[model samples]
Target: MSGRTPSTRLADTIGARPVSASAVVYPGKVWDVVSEDVDLGRAGTVTREIIRHPGAVGVLALDDEGRVALVHQYRHPVGMTLWELPAGLLDVEGEPPLLAAQRELAEEADLRAGRWDVLLDWVLSPGGSTEAFRCYLARDLSPVPEADRHQRDGEELDMPTEWFDLDEVHTAVLANRLNSPSLVVGVLAAHASRALGWSTVKPADSPWPEHPKLR
Candidate 1:
């Protein structure tokens, strides 16, 4: 053993290897697929194909009654209408994750939150994609004015909003009834954070250094 204490151990390491060469292989409407030759020091150089994404944000809107807001939206790629937290891609340049979460909450759920906290941050698929994700805990919620609501289209046009008890959602997630990544992580994180008196949550404006845009 290196004699390092368990408390001194960090979860994820933050570092980058040198990329000898890189190029986009497929340019898509939302994201792009790229190939890169990375130098791994003694391990030698290796090539990797990656899906370059703009990252995304999700909002766990908790009402005063402890119900969590959710939306049933069609995900064409998955071929299912998933129950998900209000979420959207970070495609808008220069928009902060918190703002993105707020926008998603209003647009998808027709709700706004007065209190926001960073609940969790994660990478969707570290080995295959550059998709960084952030989930926010939102409280003190209120409905947006009817006239101020965003016009929905495509998969969002017929989306339905619902609220469920946090514990119920957590149980559903563990039972495999819910599969949305954001919903799963958000509910589990919310339960754990609540157990710790919400000390696990960070400020809404906390810096997300791991996000591709920020890095």
Candidate 2:
């Protein structure tokens, strides 16, 4: 909601054909080419012949000690170590993004938060990918016991978690340590909320005390 929306125009598709069918990427039939006239400058409109993908969710968990939780992992696609907030894809059908954040924290970091609030929900890359990222701020976290932590298979995520003060995390950002955009936005949002003392109270008990935008 911070930036202006893009303008887009779509044209007609004269013909369409299936390119290939795969089990992993496209469980159903996958189309390769299509005849169409599309304008590249617009919003919610595209000339995609293939099936589009759904979006994902991101969580920025803040402890009562005033530190943000970060996860260090190796992204195979990027082929490098990257620091990101605890997050996951909403692979399941019909799952709420904020609730998914709650589940992700418990499973990935062995942490659960007492109060969760939605900070922002926006598309990460609106041009090519159909990925809409929902960012949330979680507070009053409770850690699961060491015996409760379990590592799942098929994930190369060595997410050794750490908590950093806001200033230290901002320093890391300045040094090009953090890469995820959601984390950047989440951290700034959390910092602003904390400064205004908005996130300290439960939303249910004291909803948007002054600002109509927040209400």
The model with the greatest lDDT is: 1
Q: List the global CA lDDT of all models.
A: 0.92, 0.65
As for candidate 2, its clashing pairs are: 7-41, 7-42, 8-41, 8-42, 8-43, 11-37, 19-32
* Candidate 2 lDDT, 1-215, residue by residue in tens: 66966545553232323323323344433222332334444442334442344556677888877888888877887787777888887766666556677778877778988887776565565444445566777888999778876565556355678888977787777677778787777776767777887644233223321211222
TM-score of 1: 0.95
- Model 1 clash tally? 0
Model 2 vs. true fold: TM? 0.68
Please tell me which predicted candidate would have the highest TM-score against the true structure: 1
- lDDT of predicted model 1: 0.92
TM-score of each: 0.95, 0.68
At residue 113, what lDDT does model 2 achieve?
A: 85
